[model samples]
Target: MNDSLTFCKAIEALAANIWPAEITAYLDNWQLRATRGVTKRANSVLAIGEYPQLANWLPHIEQFYADNSLPAIFHISDASPPGLDALLDSHGYALGTPSLVMIANSQDAAAAAAQKLVKRDVAALTAEWVTEADEEWLDAFLRLESYHEELKESYKGICERISDAKGFVKIRKGKHIIAVGTAVVQGEWAGFLNVVVSEAERGQGLGSYLMQALTAWSREHGAARQYLQVVASNTAAVSLYEKLGYQTKYGYHYRIKYDLRPLATS
Candidate 1:
């Protein structure tokens, strides 16, 4: 009923709704074969907040699969409150990698971009843009995310959604696609998701170019603000984003835990 609880509930709901249907159902009630929008098997972990006890949810989680069969995995951050981790660990879950959550308000961003990088005319991107994605683009996208886990279909789904949806943009150099980004519209705020630049293309200011292009796209789509997340240890990226007008609004971290121990494969 209070403002804080209301906001927390809203955040949980947004996180849940964005996942695939099977994931939502599995987390919501531990059902199987129940596919939801974009969520697929390799991408099945769903985060729930303000929910029932973890002990009660363990059966459903375990029933789905063992360690190797983990259809989906999620890093359960202490975002909920005390004792959540204890309950999860007691059930044989292991902590996973963590990432920092970041946000920016358009009201503060609408002003001239700070430390201007030579503006590339966002429209220039359209000239070199090919299909929303191609085999080469997909390969590069996967390489950037090789550090973490992700479902093949999950990326495909995201690409499908962005391709058909308005307000998505990409920029390329010759046959090589250099930059990509998407802005998910939520009320007055646009969640900037999956901004990636090829490793070979780094330091050329493509990052800032994509940021400005995405920010401009967000504004055109009626978004009043923009936000995105990066790993806490990624100092270089955080510094660049700060220079681009983003301030730390909040942070979310996750650790993956399992319900069963890993079996020897030998």
Candidate 2:
């Protein structure tokens, strides 16, 4: 493998832990992750490593998620098997949302955050770091996600299962928590998750305050690099992270095909 493909595989390996799924099963080298369809990352396939006898393996892969009442979906990245995307496309799998992985050196991100915090004049914003999440924090995070309230436990499971060093940082102005972000330190990388500024309070730079606090927390936990994944369609967030010194490290998308088995289960 070339250096670029090797690096991409490394990121995908780290990603498996950072945004863990409730269930991960393997068919050959293909990893299938699921969380009752609560989150895409948790439910999609990590199509990394070399392709096996895919013509034979694809059926089992589809049946796995079919048993779980989900469409089999593949997360396609640079490390994905050569021609896998085209094969899936030919087989009628639909293209899903594309996401970009953004990265920055921890020191550089921290420095940028420090400058942003000062220049943005967010002096009144006080930040708190909690090792464990509380109901309020989860509720706010759920609201920001625009996810159905019924999937709360699935989201909770994802967080509770994280075994790495993690800190949930929330920014407050007086008694009101205006923003929240989760930082997980795994080896040299700090993966940022569930970052959001209150809907009514956006355009006021509160997200920067929240990120700065996360940087400090991750740094103290021994992270040398910071990374986050953003949807390609989310221009505002992409722009913000670029300003904070994050650059696009890679891109991945999911290819999904709804199997009839799900309908039968339904």
Candidate 3:
């Protein structure tokens, strides 16, 4: 209802719209999303509204994830219904990664100045942009996944669903792409996502450069505010974003209920 809560909801809505799930359902105002369990964000129920219906929704939600072979999960944020945390705690749900949502004014003078250091090409994902993102970029982007072909296809599908004016950038040094990031402009807000720096290239200001590039792109596209979510335990990343003028608006975490049943003997 307040501005901060509204902003948080907007960011969540933009994310759900951009990175579409294979299936989505709504219970009252809570959003249930699932996507083959590839990512928690895509699979968890966003417990964001009134909770009078929560008791009834729980069984159905549990069955939905069980059918998909995923752990039943809920994304609990500051904007979530009051007492929901206690309810989940009573149900044996355990907390997962805690994350912070940070926001900053896109027109900040420091952000504007930092943009000057970005010399690498930072463009939106498109046919020509895909061509420009060479094998090096692909290799670096897929490092954590070990270039798993299926996950790469999912990434492409996610990118394709982003109808907003968005930018997917890869910064290269010589023949090797060292950093990547994405930004989506929605009205007065810009959401920055998937910002990564090569393991070998971090601590050299490349992360800062990528942030500035995304910030500048957002400002150019008429976004007055910028926000991003980072794992709360990632002290280094939290410090970097704070230095760049971002402040924590709220925090959220996932509550996961694993299916611990033993496998059937063959």
- The best candidate by lDDT is 2
Prediction RMSDs, each to the true structure = 5.4, 2.3, 4.8
The total number of steric clashes, by the backbone 3 Å criterion, in model 3 comes to 0
CA lDDT scores, all candidates in order:
0.54, 0.85, 0.73
Off by over 4 Å in 2: 53-55, 261-266
Q: lDDT ranking from best to worst? A: 2, 3, 1
> What is the TM-score ranking, best to worst?
2, 3, 1
Model 3 agreement with the true structure over 21-128: per-residue lDDT tens digits: 667888888778887776788889988767745555677778777777788899998778889888888888899999998888987724543654455343421111
Of 1 and 2, the candidate ahead on TM-score is 2
lDDT of 2 by residue, 1-266 (tens): 78988888888888778778999997677789989997788998888888866556777778778889888889999999889999989878899999999999988888887787675768678988888777777877878767677878888889888889988877888788878899999999999989888888888778777888888889899999989989999999999899989999889999989864632322
lDDT of 3: 0.73
Scored against the true structure, residue 9 in model 3 reaches a CA lDDT of: 72
Alpha carbon deviation, residue 182, candidate 2 (Å): 1.0
